[model samples]
Target chain A: MPDTAFADPDAGLSPAELAARHGLGFAGTRPTLGGYARQLWAYRHFIVAYSNARVSASFSLTRLGRLWQVLTPLTNAAVYYLIFGVVLATRHSTPNFIAYLCTGLFIFVFTQTVAQAGVASITGNMGLIRALHFPRACLPIAIALIELQNIGASMLVLTGIVLLTGEPLTWEWLLIFPALALQMIFNTGLGMFLARLGSKMTDLKQVIPFVMRTWMYGSGVFYASSLFAEHLPRWAAVIVEANPMLVYIELIRHAMLENVKLSSTLPHLWLLAVVWALVVFVGGYVYFWRGEQEYGRG
Target chain B: MGVAEVAERPAEAGQRIPTVIVDDVHVVYRVQGPGTPGSGSPVAALSRMLTGKRTPGLREVHAIKGVSFTAYRGEAIGLIGSNGSGKSTILRAIAGLLPIEKGGLYTAGQPSLLGVNAALMNDLSGERNVELGCLAMGMSKADAKKNSPSIIEFSGINERGDFASLPMRTYSSGMAARLRFAIAAAKKHDVLLIDEALATGDARFRKRSEARVRELRAEAGTVFLVSHNNQSIIDTCERAIWLESGEIRGDGPTADVIKEYQQYMNRK
Candidate 1:
């Protein structure tokens, strides 16, 4: 009877029920989509600062410092010009070949570098991930930002190349902003997707270079996408033309160069650019968001 | 089911609000070891995948087994345990860094985990890392910028040399730990879980950090200090939880629990 008198007031309640009664929520639960967006927004400063620090720290170690940002893409453009433009005779088919090759190289490198860095974002920052509590999306987003900054420097050089190549400055040149913005959105989304995949299957990092190389060859980075149409069959040509990288590169080329005719290869490329950006951004975001609780765990 | 009794309370239990509640929580780590049959070769892993079988060498380590404890607001609790014990695992689980396999952990706010090996950025200068760490902890850019100087001063990294301007990789381990603690403690946290971060500092720095821990507790935040140094625990915390082999062996006053832990260690 005395034991009955001392019995717990809520004997039927489970531990979870007790926790609920006290209004406690599970630790490390993934936030709702809106809530996740809010948290990510709050950490925007961190994303920028992290990316800035990475960019500075990376290039500062070399003798030329930040010049590498401009030099890396410029050198790649030169190499492609020698291979595809001079050796292969793609330049005869393309007008303003310098501007064309540089634009394609710069835009494609923005995405390619984003993909490479995104794959390493989560795995490479295990220290920060395990130590601090923030949105894991920050890593991929920061990778995109780092490349975006690099592309900014590359774009200045690109403008100079376009000017030196006798391409007249036209009102259409402002289209580069929108095109790069859309590409950034697309790259961020793709980076998030790859970050999630790379976190679990680290071997993806090794395979990404070959994939990007094949993609670059297909996207008309140094040659005309029209060649893909001539060489491959109809469906294959359409798929190759519809490639998001090709769409973005062609958009930039159209905006900067007056004489390069690409409307034949892919019409409504701006529409396709918007669509690719939206689809990849949303899909990658949701995919990365779902894995929020799994990123830092061993 | 029977209701488990809550953790031992202070004299002001009625006024205290619980910040962290670990209710019958379990954490298991699946680690790859050479002892497992399929752990060594990719071919074995491939065959296992083809056969729809689990990898043989993926050993399941039951890090924390049915542990339950409630930490109240403003209490600095020390986690004293032997090596391979579950002290760090429980801290990580409470911090939401590690996933719990069973049961649940409830915390009032985001629990920040600061371990000795928690490197923010090894290549960035200490000053830059301080700013970046503050931003990562949700401090606005202006606030982080405003607080960076005081945080650097508190870290004492600049006392000997201009280490704050040097990359973190150049700093000694102790200096790195000090800076990390300084950055974490700058902002008031609802729950701060520190793992062996205090053991690396000098006596004077330890005293200062212990005082800072006390100040944090005074500001209504729960602090969980995991250190092998029992003296620091007694110096910093009133209550301590002794973990042994992934289970709570004793949970009570720091002096008493540490004594119990010492005896068990000596006996073993």
Candidate 2:
């Protein structure tokens, strides 16, 4: 037997040391940030494909097919207009009420859908997480992409409504590109952050819709956010103006409407948009990456 | 041959590069259920509340006891165990799908787990799923697009009709399982852990998949197949590990370990 006990080569070393010596890495440990970014980059195509698949699959069973994508938000805008515009008579406070409402609704809906999807991304795709070896961030990233496409559809309807409401097309309207891009980044980050949280406490999934509704109410999606200064305390209005959803909505409103005025306290909407995108995206990504190995475990 | 000899024998035959090294790994699952103490009845809940006992329904299950093994390149190993014996749990641990509470699992490359019930996207078409699966496995867009047709063809889902166009939910379970195995097998993995995916396929598909597994081994990949079908194990794997109650009972040549497992089961 050649003295089996003495012959055992790795007997003296701890498992971690043994693995290190043999050039084996701890299988489920999170990769370094650069390495993780590279992995995410490599799977970029997967993100696109998965998001596309999800978008198509969502409406594949319906007779209207992808038209539901536009119809959903259109119907939602109509219902909100009926209640908030007709019933509450809030239209007198805002200029070009239809354009303003649609812009805010579309922008707020973008974040709302992204948040809801992000929260469910990990918990909803347990099978995919357990089956394949990939970056778990892909789920939320894909969710973000799906919502971007949804917003793209909604933007078309928003543009048509704005033009119908007699808002002129101008050079400033091109700012929508940067504004949308920043919002996408912010939404993606938030989704990723929520994906990790949702995977841990699936109960959060049930509570998310109510939270989103409350967020929408506070975001000035229907009523003018300027009214906050007139109604609420100065600190509260400033806090509400600083909300990420409000920042994004205000940015989109500025891009699409000529008459919409920038918030006086935070005249730099673009600056806030950029800062929110960078902070949330980086923070949410790290949070999600920290829980990389825990996503699929029971 | 002895257990040590079995692992070393392959080293002598080939390079014996270790692909997966699982060292004394432990996994515990904290599950909440109705049967757990102070969970079901209102009186129990009240008493537990009065006592301030946290997580009333939570029960800790030591799913994988301290288990250790090493898998080498170019080897096909079968894990034979009765239900609840931690076969799937160990596989998930190696695949990095589950967290380990103790010890360590080290691998040279990513370990992909092919479980029977892992439906990628039930509402997406099978063809779309193949593309997405390839992309998800880190294949580039062009490569995924290029290889998807062949993968779908390999699964034989389109043999009867253009079934690949239909949503995965429309396919039979066996068809879906076959498609999943085909997508997984299309990629060359350093360590592939399969959990009863083959048993869902027909006999002809099983034979084809077994042959594909050998080809994967020949490509210097380590494949661990967990199945109740001993004959498949005997045909596909040279080494087998017999597990019972979260611990390894026998580990050696397929025939020897399987014989021991059979003897133990029959005795019971």
Candidate 3:
């Protein structure tokens, strides 16, 4: 046999160099941002398939199945309307109160569901994470898509409610599409951010419902955005008006209702909505990706 | 072949390319102690929450400490260790499922870990789960559809007549594990890590899986089988590494390593 000792001695090279020379990659090193994006893009079909399967399985045990997607939110709106619109009489100050409450409740519930699902996405799928290797972001993104699907189903009911409330369809109605798209982006970003946080701190899941309830009250889901300006201090009113959910709610209301009033002091709601979506989407995405190597680890 | 002849042969004779090079890798698990302090009554939980003092006692377990090994393409290596010897941790680290605490682990391609428990969902039907499992492994829908028949046949779950149409919860543990192996082994992998997947199956199924593993190795894929069954290791692997308490105790020809390991175990 040829002398094995003198054959290609890699004695001088470092382990990384040796790995590079031999076409091997260092394990546990985070993929580059572009590479990660490419991997995620390649798994787009998987994300869609997972989202569809989860949506179908979510309501399988119930007799109504997928119908609950629309009914659950509609029923929630009905209860809130009974308490706030009739009992509490917040509707006296608001125009087209049915449309207004439905829009706000649907929009707030969309974000609320997205946030809760995002928190559970990682913790719930520890089995898949530990078993197979794929993009961990797929879990949160798929959860977001499930919420998106639910909102898509709920939007039909919302449109019918707006029409039944004697609101004439104007050119402003076309703006609802962009408004919903922006909110979806915002919800996706928030979901990803919360997923990372929830994975690290399991206690966050326990606190999210309380946090979301306070957020809903602050978002003016049951009342008009103008109510916040009239009743609250300037700082609190500014905070309420700047809430992304309120911005989305107002945008949707402006789109669907011809006579819906918006706060004059809340400057450029459209621009603020776009900026909020971008900030949360990009910020939450990067934050989640930074912890990509840490998920499913003990 | 005799031990002398086995030692005389080059370990990398047919497959000169090293598919995996685990260089002095380390893995540590941080386990939370029971003194977490806030799990009492709701009043105490609220008080502790308000004080912002939620620090729990922490314990660090150095699971794998400085494990180094090189695996060549077409070589099936068995990792034999006692309980808590970090065998599964090493396999998981190579599969890129676990983060390494220190040192370098290099692999030529994706290392797919064969875990029967993780892929199949209980609530979904077996057919649906097969499709999802294939999709989860990055298979396109069309490919998953085309492979479904052979996957079903390979798993032999169809012998029960409409069992594939039933929910996976109705499957026995052996059936579930068999289906899991079938799904994992269906796809060609560059580095496949099997962690006791064959242990749950019967003798016939184990033989079939061993043959599939050999086929994978023949395809120039490096296979790492972690098992407590020494006979399976000796039968399937040409090389073996014995681990004891987070360290490599022996590494050589499978029979040689097995002999030493058996002796050490019997003496204990």
* Every model's DockQ: 0.47, 0.55, 0.47
Query: On residues A1-298, what C-alpha lDDT tens digit does candidate 2 reach at each position?
Result: 1111211465666656766766888888889988999999988888889889988988888999999889988998898888878898888978888788888899998999989989988878877787778898988999999989999999998988889889999998998998999999999999999999998776689899999999999988887878888898989988888888889898888878987866653357778888999999999999998998888775
Error of 3 at A32 (Å): 1.4
Which prediction has more favorable TM-score, 1 or 2? 2
RMSD of each: 3.6, 2.9, 3.4
TM per prediction: 0.92, 0.93, 0.92
In terms of DockQ, which candidate is stronger, 1 or 2? 2
Instruction: State the TM-score of candidate 1 restricted to chain B.
Output: 0.92
Give stretches of model 2 more than 4 Å off.
A1-18, A265-267, B1-15, B32-53
Ranking by TM-score: 2, 1, 3
Residue B112 accuracy (lDDT) in model 3: 92
lDDT of 2 at A171: 91
TM-score of 1: 0.92
* Backbone Cα, N, C clashes tallied per candidate: 1, 0, 0
- How far in Å is the alpha carbon of B245 misplaced in model 2? 1.5
Ten-residue region with minimum lDDT total, candidate 3 chain A: A1-10
Docking class of 2: medium
Question: Candidate 1 at residue B236, lDDT?
Answer: 85
Top-DockQ candidate index:
2
TM-score of chain A of each: 0.92, 0.93, 0.93
Give the per-residue lDDT digits (tens) of candidate 3, residues A14-97: 566767878998776788888888888878877887888787677767899898988988898789888888888887787878
Q: What is the lDDT of residue B89 in candidate 2?
A: 90
Per TM-score, the best of the predicted structures is 2
